[model samples]
Target: MEFSSWPQVPMINQKNYYTEFLKRDDQILALRLQQDERLNARKKAAVDIDRARAQAAQEGLPFLEPDPDLDEDEAMNDDDIDNYGSKTIVINVGSQNMRLGLATDALPKTVPMVIAKKAARSEAEDSEPRPKRVKLDEDAPSEEWFGEDFAREYNAMAQDFRTSRRGNKRRVLPNSRELVIKWNSTTPPERIPEHSDPLRIDWTELPANPAKAPDYIVGSAALRLPEKSKPRYQLYWPLRHGWLNEKEYDNRNMLERDFFLILEESIKNELGLTHKKDWNQYSCVFIVPDLYEKAFVTKVLDELIRDFGFQRVCFIQESLAATFGAGYGAACIIDMGAQKTSISCVEDGMVIEESRVNLKYGGYDVTETFAKMMLFDRLNYADFNLMRRHDFLLAEELKEGFTTMSDENITVQTYDFHLRASGQETRKYTFKIYDEGMLAPLGYFRPTIFDHSKKLIGRHKLIPRSVDLYNGHPNDPLSPAQLAVIAYVNQTIPSAVMPAPAKPARLMPTPMVSTPSKQRLLGLPAHLNGDKDATPLSSPAASPPAEDAGTPHPTGEDANGDEVGDLKGAQPDTEVMDRTVPIMPLEQAILTSIHHGSGADERRRREFMGSIMLIGGASKTPNLGPYLEMRLRAAVPQYPKEILVASPPRELDPAMLVWKGGSVFGKLRMTNDSWIGALEYDRLGARILNYKCLWHW
Candidate 1:
């Protein structure tokens, strides 16, 4: 996964030629030298300001004398002052349009307003001719366009047209006009007026002018395109801190109010303002940007609730929101969004916060890098004359579209623009490139740094540091790497090193006791020793006692002809009880066995468990559940019970799990004895947890 190769560009040959030309040409070199001199002069002027300040300070005088040319009154109030107001507004600026809305209003209405800038296109330039159906003979050449060749041709033409001067033209064709006629299905197709009938033609029935054209009629028709639905009102505000200035903020607020007023008017205009209508009752929710503090989220939530009368407020982390939006349960959310590249692990409807990693490498960085690379490459190709000649309008688009990894080949269209119309027509260029081996400046970190280290030392050693085994002199010790390797080898040594078979727990043999009275009573053999095995009848026996009373008896038989008891609780007729014996309990066996094993074995087991939890992000990876289950089974081979994994709750967004959990706790039904309020928070001074004050809100 390492990007060991450098990125390649095709225009290098042309760039080399231009670089050589710049070095050989005298006029261009002179111009470059003059520009360099101007830059140096500007730098010198910048240094003079600091030097003058230092001299003035040393002399104990004012830094600068007042300019005689400047007005005294104007000079007195040169600094700008920010005027803060209670009533402030924020506008939501989008790529397509800017939206202004109210902040304090309960049901804020957003209006789409454009900062209009006029752009002119020459009337003499040609436009793309409309795709018209040419009535050809049935046997016309039917060249079916498909695959790479067709795609290349199609893209090449589109690129040329887009880069050409004529591409900017706007035109109105006579057939552009559309008509809506009040005709039934019974009305014949011929009755629908064509271009022939000028008098009977209902001009008002024609659809209003096209968005780009106002005066010319393109066509007359009965069929009319459906009117586009108007944009709906929604509230949006900027996420950046202090993005709006005072005046702009004020203006935005005013515009927001106006937008609401306009909406009310529109409702009356179209649907009529009626008592039964619910148009005025609206609600807004904001998807605020991720700020790295809980207090900021709480502040925004409080503001929305208190000022805007919002009933329910929910907060979601941006990366989690993206993961939910993309519908991936267990994924590494690599969101290369604005401002930051946020990577998070989403698993089982919960986001592991510790696993989240954010880097400053994002779309903006990529665009800037590409722009710089292009500039540098351009310097090699052309002299300073053609620098900044092209607008590079598609820089962002091209970067995004081309920087994708896939099996399919990609065709990138590029254009070299001409500053002067007469210099050169925009040259259409095509680049056939593959994403393989492309060097993406992914932030400085190896994908598997920790993994590589683990492999270098065998048996997944957590702490493989070097140390002298015998407390010998420093010169006699092994190097750290060698010692780490040795430690790992020692850790992985097989049980065969000891070469001893596992010993089962030794059981103490029960003493065989017998007496003339007890022997006859228990139907025991007369050969049993009286002192060693004889016991009182009331004494508790380990095994079930045989039923015999006080009387001497021979080993041959009982009173009913049943055989007398054999040695070790066995009947004289059976050998099964004599051969079989119960082993030690499982728990005792395990503890004894492990205690007897090497001390390193116990330590290694503990370390492995610790490392299991340390790989928090990896826990969420696919197939990890079953993998862990298998490992646990192997570790505790005696336990044969089925393991169970409790399923996480449905409807819980993993990214917002913590926030949602907190919200649930906050909203829980609490008694007066357990509730905590703002008053208590204030009284407790935020450190009430130390005192264990369980106040109820």
Candidate 2:
């Protein structure tokens, strides 16, 4: 495979290409929305027709029955399919987002995995007088959880009433309040009332039954909650890193059912399949991480069959699907996603699972780091509690801006954080991002400077003591903490809390509350905390808090009442601490993944590493292909490795490469007899997936 022999690359400007991609994606999304509206209208019309027929029959007049072929007619109402080509709905659900639609299109419909809730309280319930400023007791479950530590000052927990059971609802609490209080630090809202924290929300009353609340809001709409209404609308991430959060969902025994409903709705509403009367009308190809256990896979398929009545369902490895999408026979894939970056070695379309490397850092970590950097150095704000979703989104914008820009020191972007205190005039703070600020996000590529290994703790240590490991369930094989640990170690924690690696890795120093210090990264200028010429301190840990308000100190002390120090004698390197984020450098992560499998043949390894396929939204950074090629070429041990990076055709989006590959795999021509039908699943069970899917030898 010579460079000249590779497929011709499409000539398109990166900016134009992505802009057009987003535009086309918006069009597809609009179609999906229309389909949902049409579905609702049809349902209402059907109900009305039934009622009219009954009334006419009672009046001793002729009654006309509704059309028997109404569903089929509505299903074919999609006139756009004729022009765009009908496609088998392909679905790829990641922790951060869900990609749905037919494979023949340029891009799949994307929806964020975030869910929001608005309690539909009756007028009577809303008029009920609220409890006045009640202080939470220390022992009243207020101090039981890490998030609960801030509960006393702000209402961390509140109840919302519902009078109906029609919409989505999940059991959150055991008491009569029946509130599903969700607190997400990942996408915190931009503003808060005088007495509230980011996670604080008031009880909402719904018109539905008092026993149930409204199901949560899903997709991008979740981000659009009014600033003032944030306290009333609870947001949750049903899927986190790659799987369901057991702590939040598993105990309810509704995890599988909820996932089924969510995916079903996504397929019908987001993919414009609302016309399909039943799941049997369409075959589904599900893409999941290779690390998923068989039991989980079977459970998923079982629900899809029993609940949704899908006629056919087949599961495939994400790496394999990505390889097929890239049109590569063998390649090492660097999937830079929202929460985790996975480096996988795929040879001839078969994934080498043992050689795969899962890093705890990804796009979200970059945004988080950049946000902290903005708060600590660029802006004068010191109260981290005031940091809102608006700030996080701005940080994300800056990161994307810098990644696309050519200049090193140029201004990336600017955003204003608006603050309005009690009885005070609204204040606006404008923050400008520079290329130096990009260093925080740049840590993902070169992580030595932002190593946060100290944050890695044994999984059992994350829980509050109040949670009983066992609640009198004698058949329980493992405690909740232990199950969480298993999920954590396997890189499946929904909240993206990565478990510690077996081997320790080195990282660069990121000190919080230390004296201003300048540090450079690979010739790039490092901006100290508002200091132009300060030198890196010999020990950032031993350095006292530079200023109380500006440079706030995180939990840096040990049980001995001394500052927590790292192996290198600096402040503990941990993501939990402010400004310090842990990430394995891209180069190291790739190389480590390449050499991980002892059984890998030299030729297979060489071919896989020789051509690297970069996919995912994070891989959209400008010049990434050339930069990686240069890095690979300059490596000391480079041999049989004229590294060539291949992205999706310029006309196609790198962010959609995986889903595209799934589209390719789902094609009837490509997989004529591979899918497991409902009958097969019923007879053979989950092992049917292993037998049907292309196995990694």
Candidate 3:
């Protein structure tokens, strides 16, 4: 104030001034941080008191509101403090498996999300046992599902490729200069701890109850029922593609029963709950998929509270939970489970609404592929039927034990596994695999292997649809490719004239066939018939003159020589429209989710670029994180030159991430008010979850 008083200001240097200014700023920030820390400590103490009051009220104990005049810590009762949220539990449910444990536990129990029911033997089928087969239409229609003749073009391409590779199948160092000798010198591949247990729930482990055997079994034990006795039991996974397997178990009531029982039984057995009413003392933190149905989520909430009797419950997106568990502020989470791989961009404890993409394929697919490949190589286990639960478990065991991903290539090797079934002697089998082991898992990179045929050589209908996934809204359930196909069909309907097969020319957008994965997910039911007996769009006529070739549109000759292509009189074949739906592959799926993240906050994409976190059951495969990173980086040049992928630390299993994060979240004092208490649920019902959840429903 005195202009440095009588003391002259030191000779000011620009560099010194700048450094001194930064020093002052740092001091101010340091003071503010210390002040905040002191305030937070008091806030935490106050939160504890509030939570205690809320808990005491919920438990029907006398409680009083805090007196602001008194110190916050002194306002809490000692007994209330101990009883507040001490029995919180966390449950992370998945399509194939789920993890459940107390918030205080270091490890959670993992169980398969499957159940087996005692199937009724029908009178007709009981006397004459036979495999159920789908009857085909006597006269199948030959409609052009693709813009061009997909089968013909695909066959021609396959013929050319086969001819080129003929007679060159038996050569050493064939694929990538990797030798069989080098491969044999290394130790045998390690087996996953689970692979051994999934296929064999020893009879001794499952003791019969004196009260008569229950009508059903759950989890891994279901997969171990003796082959001869399997006909009496029907195994069903209540969840698929990360939701209730509605289509698989068409009966809603039965499916609901199985879904509820699988989860309830697992929780009761693992958490030491001998009685159903024990859930009243416990609260649950559930993890749901990124792309969940509104109705399904609400129903689950109602069941958790009303039927399961939880004191309170809360939901968090699986991707967001993984971020919390891994201690990352932002991440691109790739959840690879048995039935689907879901990718979502998470930032600052919330999942980006526009960055959720679920692809329906995962380790189970690779297992089936491994089974087919080994069988073709003539493995010793001759009667392997993937449809059977026991055989499916065996296939999964083999896949987990033997398969791996690599950037360089694969090596030839011989592997042996012991086949142990319930109530049967263990049998030994040996098989040699070259590219098969690697090839099967590599389906994540190469989508063609997932075709209906499963041979990986050709598609069922030879359809190849070019899909651009990032061009449309992420909120829409229909993919961008599906939307585009729909638009094309609508625009061309007025003048859809088919050209001759001999000289095909499209008057529509790019020629595309329905993608296999999405075709099943987004395609219409198979009941629609394209060969409807509707009249032609115009009267029948002979072939058009040569001048029609250059015209904007050309007419088609129906079976009766009528100018028709749109078949307007015939209702749209929803099945054909499904074929035009573009396919979604792992690589494209990751890119598409990230592309939607760059709208307002460019950092949504950039922050996640460095921390692409991989979790879920199938992500445990060695080198998967790195392999995915390489493929993603190579696929997109526009991304920053350096892209990295990270997995949970070694001590933490990827499969338990959701549960772990939920545990961490449950312990946070800030989340005390977020739980849906029974009182609130009784009034609001499932709607309470909409207000209590951590993220948007």
Candidate 4:
């Protein structure tokens, strides 16, 4: 049943089955070409018009405007905005950048998703190293544990291993376990602490701590402030790791406000929009993450319509929108954003929910890793620290400029690059890299290279996904099936008599916190601990209504599902926190998503793999397209089928591909039904999205 290798029979390779595959492949190619041509219609028209104009100028003919019985009243206007789809605005906001423009426009204007606010002066922060090294534990092996005797035995026993499996290289073969097992050195640990000391910052002299500081500068302008003037302004990145940054604004209300203001200021500065009243004329098409939080979705809807006065709006999952833009019916969507990398198998126009996987490190992590690796190799930046805003920006520029994924053995060559900081003199650096360029990018596969992975290995800041919702959040309404199950438990089970249990750690809204009732599972010898020690999930009648009927909830939720006023010994969830934090590596995640999305249908899996369309900001890395295909093939040597990694046509930029698809979708007749009007939203509240979304949530 499993395909460890291709069909061995000669007939299978040469007969009617092989012939049919070739025919299908040809058809797929033809269809792809046709789709590309169709998407490039606007570009073709512009090119042809320019040619005609040049011809007319050479012939000394006046440029004539063709009058084709057009009516001025039919033209798109602000007053009749709803009547025309061309006026629809597409917005794709990421932690690093924001894309905004009309649906009909060829390209969306891109801007940094940053804000600068006036704040009172604060003391400058300085970097200091950790305490001196402590002695090894009593049971731990001495530093010279792996001595000559162990190496002799290991080397002698390894002679019988298969030649193909015996990879004796480390710099070239990254997966090889060969180590310099000697008297003094040591065998590398399986897992290591990911982060080093990131406490150093040159710009800590700036004013902050005031999340509500008056923000005026927006986008690229925020990063343009002079080094001297920066002391009076606080520059904040409102979004982080595909969500509202709680570091700057922990309060949910302030988080939304920061997001809204960032977008508002960006639109005003980029689109030249003057006031909030103007938003009513423009419908919004927001491209959200495929694995989005339900509460976050609702809050965004409220802000876009209730506050901004947008006439109507619709949401599109990034993976689905990517399919539309890429002109593919199915693909294992791998979006490598700045702060995170997400993988999902999108079939037709829908994303397979169970297969969605998000790795919390991406382009930003790579940039940081590249900097650290370079610093170790004598990268010429004086006291270079990522915490220093300029150094971080400079490193980002260098990462994209120097990093490459080509397999052709690169010669060690010295090169020079210029770092032109804002309001500062351009500094030049000369350096030579061996394999560090490729090694830094390899962190995508060997994730420990990204220092954030080990540090993020728990439920500290873990947010609940859509599937984890409604399991027990008081705000998340339960269905009749769940209520029936709970009622059965209460009626038959003796253990159900205790107070409510604490909510699951995965369901916790924010970072780990204690509930109103200090309910913990490890109650003092159960008999000694009375009912007052209960944590979550108490009774059937206690559960909220199945349908969220727009009922108001208290400011702070009762995580323990008990009375709000009972503030007894409410300890946090005691049911062992999950320490298994590292996400499945990129290759494994993609393969798993494909298998799940396709189920047992191998043909469907083949189709998805054949068209591994790459997108997102980080996806544009040089030679990344081909390198991903090679890696995928290497991961599955048993499958001989060609794994063709498709990319955007010359007419499309990967950065704007999703936005372009949103524009294309917004103009479709079927999309009209998906749009949620202001009145409909007010009546149904956030629950309206459950019905409006095109695919099963």
- State TM-scores per candidate: 0.26, 0.55, 0.63, 0.63
Residue 419 of model 3 has an lDDT of: 61
Q: In candidate 4, which residue ranges exceed 4 Å CA deviation?
A: 1-83, 120-214, 421-424, 453-582
lDDT against the true structure, per candidate, is: 0.27, 0.50, 0.58, 0.57
Deviation (Å) of 198 in candidate 4: 33
Local error of candidate 2 at 398, Å?
3.2
lDDT of 1 by residue, 237-295 (tens): 22211111121223544434332333333233323334323422322223323223322
Better of 2 and 4 by TM-score: 4
* Model 2, span 532-590: residue lDDT tens: 45332122243443332122222221111122332222332332221222234576456
Could you tell which candidate, 2 or 4, scores higher by lDDT?
A: 4
Off by over 4 Å in 2: 1-87, 118-213, 247-254, 378-392, 403-407, 410-429, 446-583, 596-603, 637-641, 669-671
What's the candidate order when arranged by decreasing TM-score?
3, 4, 2, 1
**Tens digits of lDDT, candidate 3, 292-375:** 666567778889988999987888788888888888887888888887788888877788765676666787777866665554
Writing each residue's lDDT as its tens digit, candidate 4 over 1-697 gives: 7576776654464434424553552344333443454458546656776898899999999987533343333333544444566658789988888888777777899988877666553111222211101222323332222233323323332232223223522224432222211211221112212232132223333345545434566777666554446445656776777766755554666666767888887777777777878889878888888766676777788989988889888998888888888787778778888887767788867787645656566888778766655544444442455544566577787888888776354335556665544444445555666555766776676554455422222222433333334333233322221122222223332232233336654444222332233442211111112344443233312234334323332121221233221122221222221222224346655664565455446688778888777788888878888877776777665555757776776657887888888887876642244677776677668766765777654
Worst 10 residues of 4 by lDDT: 124-133
* Candidate 1 similarity to native, TM-score: 0.26
Model 4 clash number:
9
The order of the candidates by lDDT, greatest first, is: 3, 4, 2, 1
Number of the predicted model whose lDDT against the real structure is largest = 3
